[model samples]
Target: MNIKEKYELSSRYETAKKDYEKWGIDVDKALDILKDIKISIHCWQGDDVTGFEANNQELSGGIAATGNYPGKARNAEELRKDLDKALSLIPGKHKVNLHAIYAETDGKFVDRDELKPEHFANWVKWAKENGLGLDFNPTIFSHEKAADNLTLSSPNKEIRDFWIRHAIASRKIGEYFGKELGQTCLTNLWIPDGYKDIPADRLGPRKRLKDSLEEIFSVEIDKKYNLDAVESKVFGIGAESYTVGSSEFYINFVNKNNLVPLLDTGHYHPTEVVSDKLSAMTLFNDKVALHVSRPVRWDSDHVVIFDDELKEIAKEIVRNDSLDKIIIGLDYFDASINRIAAWTIGSRNMIKALLSALLIPNDYLRKLQDDGNFTERLALMEEFKTYPLGDIWNYYCAKNNVPVGEEWIKEVKKYEEEVLNNRK
Candidate 1:
């Protein structure tokens, strides 16, 4: 940024720091903690969830990324380059969440069930070179195998067995990623196995799903290398009437299996919020995984903003002191705008929300509630909102060597002009 902008940001931050000190909130400590919280940014945003798989099939799951924005990454190389630009603008070191469909298979056909660590060798190498960690997911959509909307829970033993092998293969790939990067890779399983209309036999499918999971997890994998998590969804486009992997089903299965239960913010009814569920999950489970997204009326996967729920989610994590125990990851893909901007904006807002949470004097608020001073507590909560959080956020971006404020937008425009626009 220009010299004038730098001076203004610093001046504003100094004033904000003084205001925070009065509330017993240490700005420096908050920044330190924020820097350590590494969010796993999903790679699908760059390519509109269209991975490097050669099939060129349409997205079939209940999920769909709308808009026809130009310059979507056509291959793994372009996707990585776009991600590099996005990460440059976002502050703090973070991890990249990848799907099995994004595997660089050297122009060879590698089905999901037969996938191996070699298929993702390039991804591991790229992540290491970029100094970022990696997380993984099994691609259970946009394939002939999943055309029926029945994967692990399919009544057909052969089809169910295929997905089970795929899940096992995905875990092995996650293990490879963790081993190479010296960090545990979260391997999440989310299958769009549900019926479009009401089915007479709901129990049968869930039972089969349980057996499939049992088979997938039968082979022991070291927790140090790979952490397994199961995600649940209320409904999907085709699976409106019944979803095999419902929240209740996954929660019970995860608890029984001693696996992490992943709660996707967009995977619930419009009235339900994952922020309210965080405390309970953290209390019960040793570690929890999150797929952070903005859901409109349904699981629309809108770009995340600094909305109330985002702040509440961040507050829950910070207040409960469960930052280390929570696995934070972004799960959204908006194709209408500049893909890089989508990534930068969502990631920055998430960090901003976390910073806001960290800047709050949680102990003081809790003490007020405990002392039955509800009026003072409510007033303080409202007053905290007017604090100069932008100043602190700007200082953070500058300190991290990322562009301060709107300056990053200029870089994105330049990239589009020089690079993204060149794609035919």
Candidate 2:
């Protein structure tokens, strides 16, 4: 921003600081806490979930990114370049998440089962240079083995065994990331193992899945280097009849095995909100993983907005004092627009919601609830909604040296004109 704009922003921040002070809110403290929070940005979003594997395969396993947006990253270099640009625009620390298919095999075909930490050497090197962390997932779909959409739970021992090896390899890679980067890397497992039509026996698939997980987690690495999490989907493109890894299934498994439960906002039914489950999960588990996204209808994986659900999710995390217990990550791939802009928008919104939650007088609200003063509690909650959130947010962007408000939009447009437009 120019001198005049920066001066105006400083003035607004002074006023906002005073307003929040009335509620005993220290804006500077909130910003300090926010600076320490890192959101794991997914690599798939930049390339529409397309990886640089030698084999050309269509998207499968109920995953799809709509729209043929131009300038999608065609290689790992381009994806990292795009992420570098996006991260420069976004404030605070962050991490990058990768799938098995993103392994850099140098034009050679490397199956998931044979994947090794060597394949992701460049990723680790790039992350270390940028002072970022890395996460991993086994690409359990979009392959010939998953042609039937049954992996890990397939009755075919060959298919299941192959994926089991893949999972084992993935965990080792996660451990490598954490060990090399001096940060814990979350390795999440999400399989699209379900039936499109009503299956005669539902228990069979679930049992197989459990047995497979037992074997996968058997080769345990130190929790300090790598953490394991499991994710379940309510339904997907082809698996409408039933999902073997339902919420109850994974919840029970996580509790039983002392593993972190990864909850995806797009992995539930329409009426079900992940915000409601935060308290319950954090209450029982020491840590939980979150894949925050916007779901339109059923798991469309739409771009996240500053919607009510996002705000509530933020409030739950802050109110329960679970920020340290929760691992937050973005999981949407909206190919309909500029991919880098999508990352900036979603990450900024999540940060904004968290900041808004921090500004609330939660102690007073809880006291009112305890004293049965529901009327006043509701009044104060509603009143805080109209507080100078924008001013505070703009000031945060300015302090972080990122473009304030819509100013970043112009930079994105300029990059598109000069860089993105050049790609065929």
Candidate 3:
């Protein structure tokens, strides 16, 4: 930015700081804490959920990336390049979440169960250079074994065992990332084992899923190296009637097993919201993980926006003082737009939400709640909506050396012209 723009940003930031200080909020402290908080950016978005698995089959198991956006990443290097571009546009150093399919096997056909740390050696090296940590998930869907829309919960022992092994390997890979990067990697399992129609035997699949998880968790890794989390879904496209890994099942399982529970914002009933679940989860579990997503009428994994629920979710993390107790990650794959722009928008919105949350006078608001001052509470809550959040946000972006306001658009356009438009 030019000197005039820099002077204006500084002046506005000062005025914004005064606005927040009226509520006894520390703008500098909030930005400091925000810098330390890392959101795991999912790698699948760059490639539209396509991975490097050789001779990959159609993306099955009830999930689909709807758009055929031009210049999608075709290989691991290109995906990494896309991710690098996205990260540069976004402020703060963050982690990258990967699926087993993202393993770089160099054109060799390596099954999920056989994946090892060596396959991700290049990723680890790149992450080290970029100062990013890595998170992983086992690819339990979009495979021949999962053609019937069942995996860990399959009645067939062979198919179930295959997924169980894959899950086991995924945890190990996550551990490797943690050990190598000095940050605990979360290995989350979101099994896509469910039925399209009403099941004759719901308990049968639950029993099998429980058994598979038990076996996978039996070979434990150090928590300092890796932590485990289980994500449950209400339903995917084909699994509308019954989701074997339902919310109740995974909650009970994770609670019993002492593993972290991951709440996907998109994986709940139409009336349900994950923002409402965070307080209880953080209160009960040592750490609760979150897949921050935007569901358009379903688990569509649309790009996240600065919506009410997004702000509420951030409030739960900040107001509850559970920022350190919650693991946050962005999980959405939208092929309808420029993928880098999608990543930048969603990630910046997340950070913006957190910053907005930090600027709230949460302690006083809670006191108002406890004192039963409903009218004033409601009044102040609505009043704060017009607070100078954008000023501080622009300052934060500028401070982090990122493009402030619409300036990032120029960078994205430049990359599209120089790199993406040529990816034929």
- Report clashes for each candidate as comma-separated counts: 0, 0, 0
How do all models score by TM-score? 0.99, 0.99, 0.99
Q: Write one digit per residue (lDDT tens) for candidate 1, span 225-313.
A: 99999999999999999999999998899889999999999999999999999999988899999999999999999999999999999
CA deviation > 4 Å runs, candidate 1: 2-4
* Model 3 TM-score, all chains together: 0.99
Each model's lDDT comes to 0.94, 0.93, 0.93
Q: Where is the poorest 10-residue window by lDDT in model 3?
A: 55-64
- Could you give the C-alpha RMSD of every candidate to the true structure, in order shown? 0.9, 0.8, 0.7
Candidate 3 clashes between residue pairs 3 or more apart in a chain or in different chains: none
Error of 2 at 118 (Å): 0.7
Q: Which is better, 1 or 3, measured by lDDT?
A: 1
For candidate 3, give the lDDT of residue 269: 88
Range of the 10 consecutive residues with the lowest summed lDDT in candidate 2 = 49-58
lDDT of 3: 0.93
